[model samples]
Target: MRYAKWTILTLLALTVFGFFHYTLPQHDIVRIVNTYQERQDLDDWTRIFWASPDDQATGLINRDVQFIQAVDADGKPHVYRNEDTGWSWPPYFKFDTANLQTQAEDLKSTAEAPKWVSVTHYGWRIVYLSTFPNAISVRPVEGPDATIIPWVNIVILTFLAVILFMLRRMWLQFRERMIDPMVEDAEEAWDSVDARADQAAAKARGLWGRFRAWLDTWKGRPRR
Candidate 1:
C-alpha cells in the first residue's frame, strides 16, 4: 500500500513537469500565428477601398486624405469638426462593407501565409505600417480555422482521465485480491480471541466482588 501511494505521487509529479516542458513552446507558436492572422484580416479589408493596384495588388498604401471642414476661414481644428472617414486619395476599387467579411476570408485563403518566424516582424509589421493608406485584409480566422488547440485539449484530457481511472481501478482490484484472504483470517482469529477475553473478564469481575464482600463482613464483627 505504501509503495503504491509513492508510485502514484511520483507519476503525478512527472506528468506535471513533462507538460510544462513539452507543451509550452508549441502553445507560444500557435498564439503568435493566431495574432498575426487576425491582424492580417482586419488590414486586408481596409486596403480594398483605398490602395491603388500596385506590384503587390493586395491593396495596401500609406497616404492621408484631407477633408473640407468649415470652409468659412476660421479653420478652428478642422480635423475635429471634419468627419473622419477614409482618405480621399483616389480609390482603386469600390469599397463595400457588406462584402468586407467575404473579401477578408478570400484574402486569408489566397494570401500565402508568411512563415511563423517572419509573421511578426515582416508581414504583420508591414500590415500595420500600411494601415495609414489602406486596410490590411481582415481574415479573422472564421470558425476554428487553422487551429487544433481546443480539440487537442479535449482529446488529451479525455485520454488521461480514462488511463488514470483504469489504473486506479486496477490497483483497487489487485489490493482487494491480495487482502481478502488476510481479512478473512483476521476475522476468524479475532472471534476466537474475543470469546476468551469475554470469559476472562467475567471471572475477574466475580472474584473482585467476592473479595469486597469478605472485607465488609469482617468490618461488621462485634468487639466481644
Candidate 2:
C-alpha cells in the first residue's frame, strides 16, 4: 500500500509537470528557412495534436495547415504549425495565422546571411506523430545568442507557485479546523461504546456467578 501510494504520487507529479510543459509558452531563437502550406489529415489519432479553430473545421477530415520551418543556433531544425487557437484551450486567442506566415516569409534568410528571430510558441514536436509546436508569435532578435528574458514565463510560474502555496495552506487549515476534530470525536464515541460493552459483559458474568452459587447451595454445597 505504501509503495502504491508513492507510485500514485509520482505519477501525479509527472502528469502535472507534463501538463505545464505542454501548455506553457516556450521561446526558440532560430533563422527562418522556409514556409509552406500542407493538407494535414485529421481523421487519425493525431487529430488531438492539431488545432480545432472553429466548429466547421472540427468535422473536416483534412485541412490546409501553414507551416514555418526554421533552424536554431545549433543548426537544429524546427517546424511550427501556424494556426489560430481561437478562444480555446491554452487561451492564446491567436487569430493571425496569415499574418504570422507572412512575417515568417519576409524574414526568411540563408545561413550565410541569417536574420535571428525569437519564435514564441507552445506545444511539442513529436516526429513520430508528425506533431509540431503551434507558433504563437515571432519577432526579430539581435543575434542567435541574444539573451532573451522570459519575463512572461517567470511571472506566470511565480503566480502559479503563489496560488499553489495558498491552496495548500487553505487545505491544511481546513483539515486542522474541521476534519481533525470530527475524526477525534468519532474515535472518542467508539471508545465510549467499547467501555459500555465491557461493563455489560462484566455485569453478565457477575449474575452468572451468583446463579451458579445458588445452584451449588441447592445441591448441598456450602456457599462462601
Candidate 3:
C-alpha cells in the first residue's frame, strides 16, 4: 500500500511538471530563416495543440497558420507556429500574429551574418505529432549567448506556491475550529453515557443488598 501511494504521487508530480513545461513561456535564441503561411487541417487530435486564428470561427476545421522558421546557434532548425492566443489558455493576449510574422521576415538573416533573436513561445515541437510551439513574441538580441532570467515563470510559480500555502493553512484552521470541536463533543457524550451506566449499576447493587437484609430478618422467626 505504501509503494502504491508513492508511485501515484510520483506520477501526479510528473504530470504537473510536464503540463507547466509545455504551457509556460520559454526563450530560444535563434536566427530567423524564413516565414510562411500554410493551410493546416485541424480535424484530428493534433488540433488541440494549435491555436485558432483570432478572427476565425471556432467551429472551423481548417485554417491557414503562419509559421516562423529559424536556426539556433547550434544550427538546429526550430519552427514556431504564429497565432493569436486571445482570451485563451496561457493568457498571452497576443493579437499580433501578422505583425510578428512581418518582424520575423525583416529579421531574416543568412548563416554568414546571423542576427540572433530571442523567440518567446509556449508549447513543444513534437515531430511524431507534427506540432510546433506557438510563438508569443520575437525580439532581436545582441548575440546567440544572450542570457534570460525567466522572471515570468518564477513569479507565476511563486504565486502558485503562496496559494497552496494559504489553502493548507485554511484546511488546518478548519480542522482545528470545526472538526476538532465535533470530535471533542462526541468524546464528552460517550463519557457521560459511561457515567450514567456506572450510576445505574450502583443503584441496582443497593436495592439487591436491602432485599437480602429484609429476608434475613425472617430467617430465624416462627412460620406462624
Clashing pairs in 2: none
Which candidate gets the maximum TM-score versus the true structure? 2
Worst 10 residues of 2 by lDDT: 50-59
Q: What are the per-residue Cα lDDT tens digits for candidate 3 across 69-89?
A: 999989899999999988777
lDDT of 2: 0.94
Which sequence of candidate numbers ranks them by lDDT, best first?
Answer: 2, 3, 1
Ranking by TM-score: 2, 3, 1
Clashes of 1: 12
> Model 1 off-target regions past 4 Å?
1-145, 149-160, 184-195, 221-224
For candidate 1, lDDT tens digit of each residue in 1-224?
Answer: 99999999999999986653333212111111111111233344555433343323333334333211111112121110011223333322324333433443233321134222100000111333343222222323323224435454567678988999999999889879988778988999999999899999999999999999989999979988
- Per-model CA lDDT versus the true structure: 0.39, 0.94, 0.93
What TM-score should be assigned to candidate 2?
0.88
Model 2 stretches astray by more than 4 angstroms: 207-224
Task: Give the true-structure RMSD of model 3.
Answer: 4.6
